[model samples]
Target chain A: MRLISTYLIGLVFGLGIMISGMANPAKVLNFFDFAGTWDPSLIFVMGGAVTVAFIGYRIVLARPAGTPLMEAKFNIPSNRALDGRLIGGSAVFGIGWGIAGFCPGGALPAVGTLNADVLIFMAALVAGIFAAKALQTLTANRAAKATA
Target chain B: MITEFTPYQSLAGGVLIGTASVLLMLTLGRIMGATGILAGFFRPMSLEDWTWRAALLAGMVTAPVLMLAVSGQMPPIQVPISKTMMIVGGFIVGLGVTFGSGCTSGHGVCGMARLSPRSIAATITFMIFTAATVYVVRHVFGG
Candidate 1:
């Protein structure tokens, strides 16, 4: 049941991307172009998403206790501090998106649609995730040893 | 140049997607994280968790087909890469999602609203990497 619901949610999300014209790499690439022929349609998509999310968060958070699908509570972050990891990661992601014209969410539908470039982008994205995880584990161990 | 959809179209679509995500969470108690869903395939199938993941992925893949039947208009896809390269890209994205702990939707939509530091960081990182990769690939490599 849970799986079915999740899949439906993803389907809707993908459909949203497609209908919003985000499934097209050219629209995304145009957004990044800035000078040549800027496309600001993404701004509306972002705005709409943020608006809905803002209201949704309020309703969800107002509950005496709220739990996401897997957990028993909303995983709200308590810390607001910025660190090297944050900055470094953001830099890398932006560069990739700007170049590839597809972020992860936008990439999935593209993959299903069988866009060759999106597939390449997705592949590299997975590789980057693994590399980051390996590094994270190593760093965690080093920090643990230092503390010990 | 990619043609832009009107604001009405974008908003209507956004509403459906956003509402669907909320409905999924309320009904099933799960966040629609794609990387996590895909990862579910690697685990034992007997686990109840696998059932939903498979269903969710199926829906994603099939939505286009359904749309084609109804609308008769599939967007033009121009990836400009080989199948091998695409696979490689997918792996990197998977790895990034794992390390980052969420993809753009998970972090950009959910995390950002909740003021999650990690999500903010992840979102920013993801965006930056995207931009840099584009620059390098399009300019440095001249692809």
Candidate 2:
């Protein structure tokens, strides 16, 4: 039941990315190009998503404490501290997003579009994820060494 | 040099995405964090829970195919860089997603929905850098 529901939702999310022209790299770039030929179109995507989510979450969270909904805690983040990783890593992500106008969600469907370039991008993305894990380990090791 | 901004289409799509996230949360009791799901191999945790991830991924990939089947045309996808540049950009994106803890979906959609301060801060920081990168790449480098 849980898996089926998630799959259905993923289908809708995928369709949304495709229909929103978010699969289009140029359109996404225009959104980020605030100084250049800017396109404010993509902002609406966020607005729509956030509004729905804001309301949907509130209602879901407000469900009775003993209900099935409350049995499984909502997987929302509770951390409030502003940290270096969150900011610095996000800045790095921004540079990448600005470069390609592709994020994980919007970019995935491009593969289904049979976009060869997108496939290449996906390959690199996988490699990068592995690299990130390695980098995280290295940093942690260095920290441990310093403390020792 | 650019196309008309399709406001209605984007908004409708956004609603679909938001609804999808809500549905996932309601049923699975999990946040639909795209990067984490996609980067399955990099999971520092156990991989026993591959059922939902695989199912969701299959649905996501099938989407464009379904669109083609329905309309007999592929969606317009514009690439901003060359093949080599794309590979590099993808790497950056993948790395950043892992280091940053999430991408557009996790941070932008789910996190924002839940009103996490970290997500808000991350979104602002990334938006600044993204806009700046576009400015620098397009204006300074003449791309």
Candidate 3:
């Protein structure tokens, strides 16, 4: 039942991405092209998403602690750090996003299109993720050696 | 570069996304960040964790079939960049999202909704860089 619920949620999220025109890299790129053919539609998408989520979060959190339907706890991010990795990583992501126009959310649904380009991008994305993980491990081990 | 302003559809889509987020929060008490979810699926800690993630991914990958039924056409997916660029950009994005601990859905939407300072900072940084990169690509390099 939980899996089904999660699948349904994922479906709804993907449909939302597709309907918002975010599934189109060209459309997303146009939003960033302020000096060229600019489209302000992406702003509305963000605004709507943030606004609804803000309100929904309030209502959901208002429920008593440990009252979640299917889980024992609310697995929310508790980190409050504004560190270099966060900022630097975001900068890197932005440059890539500007160049490729496909964020993880946007790209996932587009995978259904079965386009060769999409497939290639997905493959690269998976590779990138694993590479990042490996890099992190290397850095952590280096730091541990230095301390030890 | 030609694109139409689609506020209504975008808003509706955003709402749907928001609804999905809220539903996830309610049921599993989890955050709905696509990259994090995808990443977790790859490096799952347990069978329970892996199953839900797989389910979500299965739904996401098959969503276009739903679109075909509703919209009477496949969702338009246009990659403006070359295959080489796709690999480069995809790699950078994967690394960034992993290090940053979130992407648009995670930081731009859910984190911002929660008024997370880190998320706001990350969002601002990414937004600025993205616009700058676009400026360089479109005007400077003329790509």
Candidate 4:
């Protein structure tokens, strides 16, 4: 039952991406083109997402403990620092998005459409994730050793 | 009707995406972050986690295919880079998500929705950098 709900949620999210034309990497790329034929659709998409999110967060956070379907709380995060990792990572992401026109959320549906470029992007993305995890582990070990 | 996606459509999409993220969390106790979902492939299987993650991924992949089936076709994509560039770009984004601890959906959607300051900063940084990079790559380098 829980699995079903999760799948349904993912489906809705993907549908949203498709309907918003976010599945089209070209459309996303056009939004970045400031001096050229700039498309403002992404702004609208962001606006819509933000609006829904505002209300949604309020309702979810108000709940005591987890929601009906899950055991854990609605939101969780350990780190809050605006450090170099955040800045550097974001810069790299931007460069990639600007060049490929595919972010993670937008890339999933693109792959479904059998776009060769999206598939390649997804592969690279997976590799990057593993690389980051390895670095994170190494950093944690170094910190632990320093403390010990 | 405008050929382009209108505000109403975008809003509707946002609602759907937001709702799905919430619902998935409620059902599975898992944040609907794509990086986590994709990473599950390598993790030691607890049957429960695997089941939902697979379902989540399937749903995402299938939704667009279903749309294409029903809607007949979508507009042609306009990627500016060659296949190699796209691959490199993907790696960069993947790296960003890992270091930032979340991707756009994870940070911009779930994290921001929770009023997380880190997420907000990350989202802004991601968007600004993305815009700046796009400007340089497309306009400056003409790629």
Q: Score the docking of each candidate (DockQ).
A: 0.44, 0.72, 0.84, 0.58
Segments in model 3 whose C-alpha atoms lie over 4 Å from true places: none
Looking at candidate 4 chain A, the ten consecutive residues that score lowest on lDDT are A66-75
lDDT of 1 by residue, A1-148 (tens): 5565667776887787777766666677665555445677776776676667767766765755566645565534355657665555555555545555566767676567665576567667666665676788899999999999
Clashing pairs in 4: A69-B26, A70-B26, A94-B130
What tens digits encode model 2's per-residue C-alpha lDDT throughout A45-83?
A: 988888898898777667666233422566656677798
What value does DockQ give for candidate 1? 0.44
Candidate 3 C-alpha lDDT tens digits along B74-95: 9777677788888888888888
Candidate rank order under DockQ: 3, 2, 4, 1
Number of the top-ranking candidate, with TM-score as the measure: 3
State which docking tier applies to candidate 4. Answer: medium
Candidate 3 TM-score over all chains jointly? 0.98
The whole-model C-alpha lDDT of candidate 1 against the native structure comes to: 0.63
Q: What is candidate 1's lDDT per residue for B90-132, written digit by digit as tens?
A: 5555555665556666677666666677777777677656655
lDDT of every model, 2 decimals: 0.63, 0.82, 0.88, 0.74
**List of clashing residue pairs for candidate 2:** none
Q: How well is candidate 2 docked (DockQ)?
A: 0.72
lDDT minimum window of 10 residues, candidate 1 chain B = B35-44
lDDT of 4 by residue, B6-123 (tens): 5677667777777777666555555667766777755636986687777787788878777878888763455666888888888888888887777778888877777778888888
* Candidate 4 chain B worst ten-residue window by lDDT: B1-10
Best by lDDT: 3
